[model samples]
Target: MTIPKSVFVVDLNYVVTLPEIDAHIPGHVEFLDQCYEAGLFLASGAKIPRTGGVIIASAPSRESLEAHLAQDPFHINGVAEYKITEFQAKKHKPNFFD
Candidate 1:
């Protein structure tokens, strides 16, 4: 079988105040939901100190992923900056992507 595409570990660092970030949570969640439904996002959550968040995701290409991320409310509002790391999955549980 063909190998899957690279997975992305997205690190979001808040660029604005907590209150500003909080204001965009709802829209951000909506964006996350859409990504999950589209099978682009595998997992996501806030950081321990609430400074930002992290998301595990995959897409056909890095460009595709970046395009999707551009729609996030955080991005739109300039509330957070993203740092993306890509890796090939050499090992994983059976059907982990399923």
Candidate 2:
């Protein structure tokens, strides 16, 4: 069997008005683009009812992930709070990590 890899599920909850969150979307997306380019993020999208967002990511350690997330515009602006959960991916698509 292969060893499982650590993955993080980041849940973002809006703490401010929708307009406030919207104002940061461009910067937030730019951040996401950078993460994706760095192969740190797997997937991300906004939640239904437009509450907040979620991101699936992988990193060497939780500390590293936290550091990266700290750069997010929402985090910087205090418009959203993040709750991150880490889990081991014991089973996933054949090329999920490729």
Candidate 3:
């Protein structure tokens, strides 16, 4: 089965130092959890080897997603910066589901 095709996409770059990734973990978890509970975040994590983070979610529009993203702890607490782009996607196997 294919996953639904409405998601908020974030390309992330860290601004905070290594020390802060550790310090920011708790707040990040809390805010991210809030996002999850609100049905905002679907899949999220670092883009392998810790170069950056990516968040996939559902939102009605770019503006709506941006507003939600603006409240994320990483953004609010200055741990990372992000660029948001809205997407309607269906990924095939290897990329996701076939």
Sort by lDDT, top down from the best: 1, 2, 3
Answer with 1 or 2, whichever has the higher lDDT. Answer: 1
Model 3 TM-score, all chains together: 0.77
lDDT of each: 0.93, 0.92, 0.76
lDDT of 2 by residue, 1-98 (tens): 44336699999999999998999999999999999999899999999988999999989899999999999999999999999999999788777766
Clash pairs, candidate 1, are: none
Model 1 residue 8 CA deviation in Å: 0.6
- Candidate with the larger TM-score of 2 and 3: 2
Candidate of highest TM-score: 1
Each prediction's RMSD over C-alphas, in Å, is: 1.2, 1.4, 3.6
Model 3 over residues 6-83: C-alpha lDDT tens digits? 566798888867678778778888888998888777788887767669988777667788888788777888778898
lDDT of 2 at 70: 98
Give candidate 2 regions above 4 Å deviation. 1-4
Model 1 compared with the native: what TM-score?
A: 0.95
